[model samples]
Target: MLGRRHLLGTTAGAIATTSLLDRTRAWAQQQPFQPEPGATLRFLRWSRFLEAEDRATTENIRAFSEATGVPVRIDSVWQDDVLPQLSVAAGIGNGPDLAWTLHSTPHLFADKVLDLTDVADYIGGKYGGWYPLIEQYGKRDGRWIGISNLVIGVLPVYRVSAAREAGFDSFPTDSDGFLRLCAGLKRIGKPAGFAFGRAPSDGNSFCHWLLWSQGGRLVDENNAVALNSPETLRAVEYARELASHFIPGTIAWNDASNNSAFLAGQVSLTNNAVSIYGKARADGMAMADDIAYANWPVGPVGVPTELHLVYPFIGFRYSRYPNATKALLTFMLEGPQYERVLQSSAGYVSQALHAYDDSPVWRSDPHITVFRDVAARGRPLSYAGALGTQAATAFSEGIVADMFAEAIGGQVSPREAVARAERRALRIYRS
Candidate 1:
């Protein structure tokens, strides 16, 4: 299995072979061309959501088989399982024809991944409504290395009922109201007013979004470490205060624990990604109905709520059947099949605005609306050659979880943590 860190490199040779075939076809264009048959396509997908015997993934695979009359096989695995599988693929050439994983982590696969710039031009030329931020997120060194058919946004997941019970009729649209909402939740015996997990990745998501909303930049347009600024410190201080109201257990919580606590109804508010809604529905948890989402609240600076995003897709880099791959990707993007996947998987929202036009998930779900709005305004996660990965690691490891544990757990001040994060990040950048 390939680790997420190196999954992209897993099928490098195969991509080369596929690119060779594409070039061969290009050279043969002057001759009368006949469609080739018996070309099998394989895909590595997030198996849990769509691969179960009767699930959306399974059905989508079936539909792909029918739509193209080409046999499509998928090696399904859990999202977390992909890294380990890719680790194996890196050693043994047994991975699928295409992989669907996080766009941020695709750098791990950059060497082996196909540059989809031409494919993106094709998709955009035809669809003309793909997520702009996602297109940017999928690129590395000015070439499209991945495609994000789905978009995820970070936001505040709140207990609407709890807020109303606490005498707030509407969700807060700004930062002060958010703090006040937390305070009010505390007054009503929700000891844990809001909670976010202590994973460096989770922290990176929160920190970047906070900075973006406050008119702060992790790196300027020029790409330098900007984590030590007064603006950033203010964001950290505000986060520290919010951490103070987190459930006592968050000190030890990683990604799962925080979501578990939120799921268990121990917390009233959580600033998290939109993926939670799907998880909530899958579990059929009682709190699911009570859960509603809001834009990452505006800061004092009047920046709207921001979200750290994840973009995902299946690319044609290793496809023996480009037409088939294009057909499948296009089908998933253009119709109800795509919506079914998004709704059932509780995955990220589609990057397409028209996707919202016909979606019950967009129209009927409160959380979905906030997520959609954030998508409309948000930028992709910041990346600068190696800086994005390094910063993500630093923020995830040094600042997010560990620092919160130290500061809110009575070991240090938030200021100290931010300074430490800056020093550590600078070292990583310099190194």
Candidate 2:
């Protein structure tokens, strides 16, 4: 479609761009960061992100290293690897300067983290203000012990074509409708999926939203155990019925299984991060256009309740490079560098800063536009309550996921499952 001269010019332009990027990386890597007499910044981050975004992060970190003379070392680990690594590090009071993890790891180790109130306050004052949920996720008592980094949009990804065949022309808008739809889906080979195992993130997130949307909560705003209640009873009963339509082996599924299930067309519906949909589009997979994302179905409460697994970076109290660590986080979260991270992620990563909610990534794709406002909506793990030692302990213990799993397993009655969960919660709270 191009003339020889035009093709040559385009090739030259790409070559020049590559050359410039290579030079930039070389310069950044060469320049040593030594902000002060004794300064070093080490980051432990999840290796998984949009590939280009991870590259951008590495480059940005190198630039930070160059600018501050603080040799920044980024140790990338899998999401699953992060928490255990952080736990051991916190237990010993020694680890990477910035411990990156999801859920309530920060709150679980708040006592071992350096107070970052200044970091939080400065960012809040400069960028309008911190989101209400970000404060709860990052703060300990009254001090900010962690830097809430970003959110990955978690919502329902379903096959529209399959839904149509299942005798539904539109997505379910509420829990009861959702139940009937799943039942219909089961009539066909395709089944709705919300992981039923102790499989952590996806399972817990969906079950919690299921409970919360039904006017149930693990704890109230007052930090009281709200797991055992009439609302929870109804939720569990609803969940038990819904689980009947789940795909086989959902009970043993880890996070990746759902993605595969959705892609393989074995599932008509599933709760997943944008990653699932993003991957389909990126890879030009067969099922790409057939997929659509939707909000969590509403419930009797008439409010949309959703849970997102948030990865917040916390500076350990034992870090000798606390100041540098704080600066690194602040740098990543602000200005052009932050925007670059968001842009390169291609709608996969959402920001805590409300101003950044207008990120163009979601707008890039029509189907994914649902994720644009998700950052402002989804609640953290400790939602409907506080992120504290008790709540963190319960989440880390996987008791909540177990509760829902128990209800669906039908080995125990829904009431018994909640009672068991309540007993665990009371023990956690009392401890």
TM-score of each: 0.77, 0.89
User: What is the C-alpha lDDT profile of model 1 across 292-338, one tens digit per residue?
Assistant: 87666678777553545564664534445555565555555544555
Off by over 4 Å in 2: 1-34
- Weakest ten-residue segment in model 1 by summed lDDT: 26-35
Name model 1 segments beyond 4 Å from true.
Answer: 1-36, 49-54, 67-69, 87-94, 165-167, 193-197, 200-204, 214-217, 272-290, 314-324, 343-350, 353-360, 365-367, 383-401
lDDT of 1: 0.60
Q: Model 2, residue 402: what's the lDDT?
A: 85
Residue pairs clashing, model 2: 33-69, 33-70, 34-69, 34-70
How many residue pairs collide in each prediction?
18, 4
Q: Model 1 Cα RMSD, Å?
A: 9.7
